[model samples]
Target: MRYAQVFYISIYLLAVSFKDVLCIVDPVSLSIGAGVGLGALYGFNFMKDQTYCRVTECCNERSIPGNIGNLRDMLQKRLYGQHIVKQQLISALEAHFNPRISSRKPLVMSFHGTPGTGKNFVAEMIAEALYEKGTKSRFVHKYMGRLDFSVEKNVHIYNQRIYRDVVEGITECPRSLFIFDEVDKMPPGVFESLASLVDYNALPNKLDGSKAIFIFLSNLAGVQISDQLAKMLKNGELRENIKLSAFEQILEKASYNLDGGLKKAGLIEQHVIDHYIPFLPLEKKHVYQCTSAEFMKWERYPHKQVIEAMLQEVITYDRAHGLFSTSGCKTIEKKVATEVWIEKQSV
Candidate 1:
């Protein structure tokens, strides 16, 4: 509204200058002509302002409505396994979106796990649920750590570029979601550039990002996280008993010990990130569930024997220690596709 008023005044001044130029040629009718011209300009601006407000109001009312229950239901239906991960994410999102919390910072969630454990899958699901176009939305920006910071010598340039891009994104759409995949590959200074946006303190330039969400996906602490979970399971602790808080310290320590940029950038040390959600390594059972889900997606329901045969095609590692998917469910679809093709050929 303030901007509209400023624009109106600027255009009126331009009209006044043109009126003065015309007055020199027709001095006798200057007052009458000036009054009519200015009145018409004012009337046009008033109508424009009203139309702008009406359009903005209609757009706001048409936006998708979301709540905690809707988010949880979507997660449960789309994501398999990682029950704890889903719960923590829901709680964090609920807190971030609560209207009563005025001092809220941008929601920064770090997903630490191996590939194919649904880290990226969960991120995409959240985007789809929150925004109308899902990941395809212009408001949802994705950055690859490796590609953005590939040259170590140009870290300083990349850092500035990252800061500008993020600030501009939030400026355009305050509710934007920024996903950083393979965060472990980012340079130290590059990731640190985003600290200001994530911090609770208001940015110096007044770029309010409290309504935005920043999701970091990394494979840095996967092994240590899995080891901790395995140890808990061996100690007669139920799988459900393991919570994020229980291994928060261990995960932090392992993340810091690693050579990744996450620790080097001081994100964990500074406590800039809100939630550190650990995605436990998927077991054979979970993989089977993933396989089944993929088949269902293709609308092809194979018999149990065929499903078992498809599972056999996916190679697992370290049977002597404890079996886990080599690449998680990342390649399950491709393997399933091949097996399905082979089965059809045999028939």
Candidate 2:
């Protein structure tokens, strides 16, 4: 809309110049020349800028709008064994995405727990909740710690790329979601590039980090969280009684004392991170629920006896007579499939 006037004036000037050169041209010839020239100039400017989204698939201010109810339902339905993470994440997102009372800071959340405990899964759920295309959305960017910053020698190079990509992403969509997987193995210096991006006052080049969200997934603190859950259960506390407060101090201390992700980074001291969510280990009931869900996903009937048999044969317990699955819900689908394959072969 803003460029329409300029385009029209330029076309008028081109037509006048063409008329001066083609003074003896017929009326039809003049019209054709002017029309073609206008088209040519429009195409040139369109290509020169090259940033315009000709199609409607591009993400703009309204593309990745999130529904808090949808997010809550997704967490409650899909994510199992971590009541604390689901509630904390939902509450934190509500606060961050709230336009009326937002703190004007990027929502920085770190997910800590055992692998397969739904750290990455929850991140994907968040993307799906916010985006039409889910993780495939252009507004969603994921960086693998091992693949993106494998070598410590390239810390400087990684720093530049990290800053450039994050800045570009935030500039494009303020509601962008950036997920960093396996951050436990990420180089400490890598956090340096991201420190300011999560800050409330991060205004490099006037880019607002407040509208974006950053998620870091790590297996760090998994043992501590699991141990705490086990102790709480042993003390006769109901699983539903488990709350964020029980693990909040534990997570804070883990971030400082344990060799967790961003442990050496002082984001905690700067009070940049909004939440440190802990994913609990999967218990018998949660694992059974996951197995049932996986079977349903594969269009297989979730038989009670079959599920019990598979869990018995495949799942590794925390200890003798332990209630928790050491590996959480990580490989439930694979285990289910293998059990089905074996049963088919035997039959």
Best by lDDT: 2
Residue pairs with backbone overlap in model 2? none
Runs in model 1 with CA error above 4 Å? Answer: 1-68, 342-347
What TM-score, over all chains together, does every model reach? 0.80, 0.81
Model 1, global lDDT: 0.76
RMSD in Å for model 2: 8.3
Summed backbone clashes in each candidate are 0, 0
Which regions of candidate 2 are displaced past 4 Å?
1-55, 339-347
Q: What does candidate 1's lDDT look like per residue over 1-347, in tens digits?
A: 66865675677777777777666767666876687668768775565556553443211213323346766887887676687898899989888878888745788888888888899988988887776667886778898888877677787897788788888888867777899898788656667677765787655578788888899898988887777877788889988777888767766776667766576565676788788888888887788888888888777888888778767777575443475676778998887787678768999
